[model samples]
Target: MKIDVHGHLSAPESLYAYKANLLAHRGAHGRGSAGVTDDTLRAALTEPNRTFGNQSHLRHLDEAGVDIQLISPRPYQMMHSEQAKLVEWFAEETNDAIARTCRIEPGRFRGIAGMPQSMETTPERWTKELRRCVTDLGFVGAMLNPDPYEGAAQPPALSDRFWYPVWEAVCELDVPVLIHSAGCRPPARESYSLHFIQEETLAVAAMLSSSVLDDFPTLKIIVSHGGGAIPYQRGRFQPGALRAGITFEERMRKLYYDTCLYTRDSIELLLRAVGTDRCLFGTEKPGTGSTRDPRTGRWVDDIHLLIEDIDWLDDGQRKQLFETNARELFRI
Candidate 1:
């Protein structure tokens, strides 16, 4: 069972709904409309039967040797800056779309809900929605934007006490939270790849420096995008933690990482840093762009092939990375 833990849905109905709501009350929302136009978004959304978990997506998954995918809304669609009511509505709609997709083939798709993370949203509010997704909707997990303020206002750090309630909720529910960054507020932070890396790196560092993990000891956080440069910067963090009487590596062990790094060397580095038990297979397929691999003459977003190419990992370790870890973490 090769489970890809990172995948995204671009639901047109939800997007159009949010766009209409955002446009109707222009002054109420903080962030302006950006990115792909409605036509393009709709065109992308209308792809065959599978938006993320449909037949087309499953065909690709079969080609990549992926048995299942934990699907969530695209990060850009996680409109964290809209009014709380609208944000909640959008989240429900998005999660419903994901549920719909998963319904197409339960064996091939599982759901990860989107949260309503506006500035006005309280942890109690998050807990409510999370419970709805998990208990009623049959979702396995959720995506949380630690910085929900987006372009509207400065947001609290992931370590802030403001997020404690949400952390407690996740611990109580026994569901992992995929700590994904959303919405590029500042123009300088507009590049999706660059912003994702920056925010994920910062989120990890903040969690390390704070007591949130210690407080909710069983809480699971799977950082996306190969932990966003965290593995490469171990020299900076590990040594500093040693000086501060802390074991950085031990702290990082509590969290999980996905294989979305796009290269053999980067995945190997992550494997060495976190070990097989803490890493899961993730292609970000159909969402992440592809390029040709000169060696194989095949397009390269198929991360399963990349994992297979790693010469050092034996069959057992490969199983752990590709399937066992996800099954245990998401309880699928």
Candidate 2:
């Protein structure tokens, strides 16, 4: 029962419309185009659906030994820079596409909804859309952007009161939120992977340092990208937690991480620092950087083999990391 909890979906029509809107707006502002060129973006957006239900994705799953994938909209499709209304509409279209793909092979896929996290989006709207995704669309969870204020505007941090309403809704709904970053805005943080890592790590640190977990103890968050350097920098944060009279391990235990670190040593470090129970199997497959490993001749995104190669994990622990943890976290 292997499950990949971190996978992305790109609905071509929805994405193309969003890109068109962005380009038009940017041109008006004399900012030209934003992000990828038209041709590249369209190709990447359509590639996932080309073999969505035609056994191509299934064949990749079979070869990679993944039994199920919890598909969410591609990070870029969140469109946090757009107006809140457009963002919500884009989310609906993206989720509909995901539901359609899941219907093609019900047992092979589940859905994680995308949220309209633009600065103007209200908590009521967020809750309504979340309920729609869960009760109506049968989605298991959602992706949350810690900061959605694009460009020069800095939004309130996740620990501030601005996010309390969403936190309340999450606890009431009993669904986990995968903390994911979308689109880099800062000049120094232009690289996608680097910016994502920085944002996710800083968000987690801020959450830990503040009273967010204490305020909503039942809230579940899965920090993507192997907890984003948190495991490696435990020493830097431990002293602060100790001085603040908080249990560092207890706070960390409440959160979960996914296996997208892309290397054997990094995965081992995550397993050691975060433990097996808190780590969920995830692979952002069929996206960028999924090249064949020269040594193994397997796609680098095939992370199941990476876990299998770890010598210390017994069968029970491996089972927990590969399947049980995700099942419990996402309620799948």
Candidate 3:
């Protein structure tokens, strides 16, 4: 019954074609995996050199005891990188590749399609792509970063009327709109630092403050990174949101958050703040320093400790936190 709602894979079907693309863009974290071209990308899936390939990804899933993985692309694919037209093509290709992968395992793995956030594209084209992802490709929903880029440099907020058509399609499809935290230009903060957490927190806050959910009430939104500090800061920060003519509590109730905070204490606080039904399981698999402890000879299962420490939660609550909640949220 264990399911990991957060997992990542690159487009293996076209690795060779994008090798140069990958090389040009080193990971913000300093090291980079070998980039793949179109031809080799497909080949790389079966290869071990790339950790993001199918073989490596699936191996990690099995080792983690995850029965199901809801996979999405690494952020590059999600950002609609180069431009609108190319972004559209990339979205289609990535979704198609994931659909193909899910077919091999049936219920064991699922995918969320990438959405293009380009300002240059026609609204009709954006709507059409979203329809295709939901209806034709069989994806659960779409993945979106809070802001495609950061600060004054980033494009207009996702709540802008320009994106109304896209939101309309999402509402019509009745799938969750997963808001992830990344892709900010200049990053604006260190990884896992207070500023990093604050950046995501502010993004969600801005969304709520802008009344995105109120404008599109039917669209279910899932905030990643343990709801990005929203649960903790809601009471203290909500008044400003309210004063700015936004009231998201009702809409917020419909939103869900993933448990990617990586500690029992943080997860417990989130559960209390958002409730068990609103929390889903996530490892941020291969999270920073994801290696095992060499001296203790331990695999370092974080969730195991989370379950053990939260004794107040009944058996049913634990089961819900670990598995059932995610299945229902993703409609798996």
Question: Which prediction has the highest TM-score against the true structure?
Answer: 1
10 residues in a row with least lDDT, candidate 3:
26-35
**Full candidate order by lDDT, most accurate first:** 1, 2, 3
TM-score of each: 0.87, 0.86, 0.77
RMSD in Å for candidate 2, one decimal? Answer: 5.2
Alpha-carbon RMSD to native, per candidate: 4.7, 5.2, 5.7
Q: Supply every candidate's count of residue pairs whose N, Cα or C atoms clash at under 3 angstroms.
A: 1, 0, 12
Candidate 2 residue runs with Cα over 4 Å from true position:
21-56, 186-188, 244-247
Candidate order, TM-score descending: 1, 2, 3
In the range 190-234, model 1's lDDT, one tens digit per residue, is 565677787888888888888888888898999998888888988
Summarize candidate 3's per-residue lDDT along 195-306 as a digit string, tens digits: 3365567656666657677788777777777777777767876676577676545435557877777667888888887678887787656443245556644334345456
Runs in model 3 lying further than 4 Å from the true structure:
10-55, 76-81, 122-124, 150-152, 186-199, 238-252, 286-289, 293-301
lDDT of 2 by residue, 1-332 (tens): 89999988744453566557754574344322223334443344344444343224445667788888988888855768676666676667677777766766688889888877767767667778888888898888888877676434677778888888888888888889898888765554466577678778877787876888999989998989888878888877787778888756656766899998788889999888878999999887655536677888877777888889999999999999889999888778
Model 1 clashing residue pairs (backbone)? 50-54
